[model samples]
Target: MPGNETTHPLLQRFHEGDPAALGELSDRFSPALMGFAGRLLHEPFLAGDIVQDVYIKLWQRKGEYDSIEGIRKFLFVATRNACINQNEKYRLRQGQPPSSEDADPDEAMRKLILSEYLGLIYQIVAAMPDKLQQVFYLSFEEGLSPEDIAQQLDIPRQTIKNRKVEVYKALREGLKHYKVAMPILLKMLFPH
Candidate 1:
């Protein structure tokens, strides 16, 4: 992680819509991401494939990136999730579940779901107006209080609350198609 330079170099390149940045990112972070995947997958070649697959996704989605996005966190989380998914799919295809090799399967699944959920959230937030998106993340993700958010962002507390409300309203309306068993009341709570 390079302070102020942006922790994820690939993300920076991806931000600029540079194909070469994707390659440079692969060269720089592949070693680390591959090593992490190898530990989880316990296969060198498969880990390499996993890293490749992760980069492939970045290449595909790079055009959507903007400067405000958190590239490093996104990469680490997405890679871990993709590796987990790939590993599980491979296991299922082989018609064999792990015997003694099983770690906490529930935890693994939770991680995968959480990672996907976060990625979806990022996509939604990124699609929002820049000020509203930043306010929402800082207030919710960073856990800043309304007063704190006002001070940090140099805005009125009421404005932050209104922005949050507007943001939630849009998400609820936008996600009306999802039948996730989540009650509609929760959407109202967003103040959006």
Candidate 2:
């Protein structure tokens, strides 16, 4: 759903103007995009509106992307830019100046790129087998150490460590296309 291998066929169908493929893409990505926009704008209704606009734009420009990866990148980048514009408009309407803290263009671009890559990583993790997924979420999302995860999951500590190693291997293989180094992925996932 986040531009992994399974999505390649769907993306190919969409490029051929198949409405069902468009629907599939929308179903896969809309919720994540809504959450991303909501975080940026701090308004659930506005975020929904932005995500709707994104779908509309995607339909209108279906020929633009030959790969699911390209589509995924464009979807997030477009949603982010839309959210920034909407935030500025909302501020103007409330008689408040646009936030100067976020005015730096480079910082904004970095945040957008980070968010996109993180979304891809999340998709890969979600696709993992159940035990491995649980291990990874415990390690990263819950900020638990391998020992803590072993206790929580009623598994041996060594098994937990092994599962973590498997998770790293899976992530590295899945994200090879993005050129993400294992160390950076480890920092993002394990974050000590």
Best by TM-score: 2
Q: How does each model score on lDDT?
A: 0.62, 0.77
**Tens digits of lDDT, candidate 2, 1-192:** 454643578877887899999888886677557656765674547988898898889989998886776777788888888987888888889999886746798887677666666666666765678898788767876789888998999989999989988988888888788865669757876963
Judging by lDDT against the true structure, name the best candidate. Answer: 2
Q: Candidate 1 lDDT, tens digit per residue, 1-192?
A: 335444356656667678787776666455446545654563446877777777787777765654323444556666777766777777777886853234878876765654444444444555678787777667655667778888998989999888877777666665567544334434422333
Model 1 alpha-carbon miss at residue 153, Å: 1.8
> Which portions of model 2 miss their true places by more than 4 Å?
1-19, 26-57, 60-64, 82-102, 177-181
